[model samples]
Target: MSKLLARIAGYLSNRTLVGVDKLGNRYFTRTEEIDGIMKEKRCVIFKGEGDPTSISVEWICWLNGQRKRAPTAEEQMELEARREPVKQNVAFLKQEEEERRAKEGSSHKAKSTGKTGGPDLKSFIHQFPTEGNKLEEESDAVDRGRGEDEAGAQKAKEPLSE
Candidate 1:
């Protein structure tokens, strides 16, 4: 009971109200001597049911010590105001994309003749030489060119060898 009383007294004395979020959640900080060194502790008192998702990014940063100071109400309001336009732009872009896709889909459906069979592979193959023969012929031609060049070089060297 004495320990509980001491803890209550400590909290009442040391805890400092840092800020309140838009959701009515309260943020606080307190300094305590631990291991003979002063350390600051931060915490939040949720407005209602303690849903952590209710916290904003700025407050989360402050709570996590990523930010040295809590965000001001004006800063929060300004950020929220800025976010509104971005949200509208994103919604507009999504709607535009959906409209474009719908147009493309309708056009495709109109153009597509219901004749649904696989593509004419025979006609495609006819557009090029027989694959096996073409590859072998190309390799043979390359080898022949290299052999002729090597023979010519050897012939030129033979005269110099004399």
Candidate 2:
């Protein structure tokens, strides 16, 4: 098929027919995975006679045939053991990141509080003006001066109202 020929050409530069007859041309076979299913199919490459790609395809098929199935239980356990180092490395990196964040957070709080060694929340609150104290001071000052000037002027103008 045209699709098969294109696929084969991608993996090879030159190809040659191992045999041919009146029925159909049977080129040398090469194995490839088709939709996760490994299969061997005849390849047609456009190169001239005595192309080396055919021999390469034969070796590829041989290698495919030599591949075995998945590993057994003991082999799977061995693979899991091999992954422990990677897991430990990831955990160490995470711990280092957490420590770095904690350090940065403490330093930022200390800067906001104007503290040298560490953050002090009580000292930071002392910098702000309290609404209750300010209001009380304003009200007392207004009450003490209320109507004093008017009282003085009225007393000076009255001619002994008694």
Give all TM-scores, in the order shown: 0.53, 0.26
Off by over 4 Å in 1: 1-13, 105-162
Predicted candidate 2 versus true structure: per-residue lDDT over 1-162, tens digit per residue:
999998888568433344432223244555678899987655433344554444333333433555233233465457667878999999999999989878998888523544557566777887665666876787788876776777888889989956
lDDT values, one for every candidate: 0.92, 0.59
TM-score (C-alpha) between model 2 and the true structure: 0.26
Worst 10 residues of 1 by lDDT: 106-115
Indicate which candidate wins on lDDT. Answer: 1
- Residues 1-162 of candidate 1 have per-residue lDDT tens digits of 999998898677889889999999999999999999999999999988999999999999999999998999999999999999999999999999989879999878545667699777998878677756897798899999999999999888886644
* Error of model 2, residue 24, in angstroms: 47
Give the total clashing residue pairs for model 1.
Answer: 0
**How does candidate 1 fare on TM-score?**
0.53
lDDT of 1 at 16: 89
